[model samples]
Target: MIAVCQFGGSNCDRDAVLALRHLGFEAERVWHADGLPAEADGVVLPGGFSYGDYLRAGAMAARAPILREVCDAAERGVPVLGICNGAQVGTETGLVPGAFTTNASARFRCEHVHLRVENAETPWTAGFEPGEVLTLPIAHGEGRFEIAEDTLADLDDDRVLFRYCNEAGAVTDAANPNGSVDGVAGLLGEHEHTAVLMPHPERATLPDLGGTDGRTILRGFASEAEG
Candidate 1:
């Protein structure tokens, strides 16, 4: 079963559960205070303004006691995916690198954007091919990714997972909706089994919603569990 972590302000918990079930996975929303289920095979930090985005997007929730269990599971190689606000929590908890800060536009951006697959080998991206473009929706005011120069260089060598890009798959400033450094949209964690992204993959998983490109992203969990 997959555990969808739900904090006080998380709005995407149900959406995440629905998306995962649609893809043939057993999933349930697990309240933050309830802690992780031992039966959980994977975990997802769905998007939303956890703790009302207090003290920064995810600072409060990152310090939640439940995350300690989440961190332990991650260290044991359990697949963990953090989307949007969840991505912020992941970084705040040191589950992932870099930070999602104020957008370059300094305003909330909510729309469809293209993301180019930078590395297709990781469990989170194995469904895609290098240079493949995916249409995903992003809605956030503080989604810019910031990392140090040396860290950026290391991420380059580690082969970061996703980057904002044009329809033609060109990484350009104009295509960057959040002004993330190097157009980074997603990144793998210290362990490849974990990842975080600012885009709403769960929102894009239903065909009726628009496109199902996001399904591939969620598939990463099942892939890792099976392996």
Candidate 2:
């Protein structure tokens, strides 16, 4: 079974789980404080204000016992994804290098923004076409991604992934909503088995919500797992 890590302060656990189930996977949520589940095939860190965003969104939650096990899982090449606050945890844990800071706006804002898929090779994005615009929801105070210039170059060369204009089919800085470095919304893991993104794809999993763009991303993950 796949395990979705859920911390006490994580509010989107159920949504993640629901999306996973919709995709026909057997998923379970494990508390962030507990050790990683022994039988997890993959792990997902859903979006939320773990510890109420105290001392940075995921700073305190990074040290939780479950995260240690998650680190172990990541090193073993288990597919893991961190979304929003979960993205912060991924950065803190070194699953994905760099960190997220308060948005240029300095306050939490929730709205739909356009996202262009810059990389279609990752498992989570395999179903998307390069340069596709996906209307996804973003709600966070800290979503800006910062990385060293050298690493940024490496990411570009390796196609680690990037966020682009959801409307113009272009990767322009102006379309960026949170001022993420390089207009990045998602990135591949060092080991190529993990993915972390600030946008909440899970929130857009159903047609009732007015969009199903996220289904492709999640479907890609399951297809890779099956393959």
Candidate 3:
């Protein structure tokens, strides 16, 4: 079963559960205060305005008791997917490197974006091919990915999952939706199964919703579980 963490202000928890269920995984919304289930084979930190975006987008929720279980699950090599606000929590908790700060425009953005696959072998991108382009929705006020120069240089090639790009797969400043450094859109954490991305894969998972390109990413859970 996949546990989708639902914090106080998490607005996308249901969407995540539905998307996962559509893909044949047993998924359910697990309230943040309730702790994770022992049967959970994967954990999803869904998008939200946790704690009303107080202190920071995901700062408070990142410290909640349930997060410990999430961390332990990741340590055991279970898949942990963090989306949008959850991406902020992932970075805040050091589950991944870099910080997600205010957008370059310092304004909230909501739109579809193209991303080029950087590491097709990682579970998060296994459904895609190297250099392939995927269109996904993004909505956030602070989605910029900032990393120290040395840290950026030290990241393994496989650590990068996807980068913002044009429809044709060209990585350029013009294609950047929120001015993320290097146009990075997603990243793999210390373990290949753990990933965080500032895009709404669930929003793009259902064909009736207009697109299903995001199934490529969410399917990582099934891939990891089967492995």
Q: What is the lDDT of residue 40 in candidate 3?
A: 88
lDDT of each: 0.91, 0.80, 0.90
Candidate 1 achieves a global lDDT of: 0.91
Per-residue error for 88 in candidate 3, Å, reads 0.5
Residue-level lDDT tens digits of model 1 in 1-227: 88999999999999999998899888999999999999887889989999999999999989999899999999998899999999999999999888999999999999999999998988888898989999999999999999988988876545578999999999999999989999999998889898999999999997798888999988877768656
lDDT of 2 by residue, 53-94 (tens): 888889888888788888887787778888888999888878
Give the Å shift of residue 50 in candidate 2.
0.4
What's the distance in Å from true for residue 14, model 2? 0.5
Worst 10 residues of 2 by lDDT: 155-164
* TM-score for each predicted model, relative to the true structure: 0.97, 0.94, 0.97
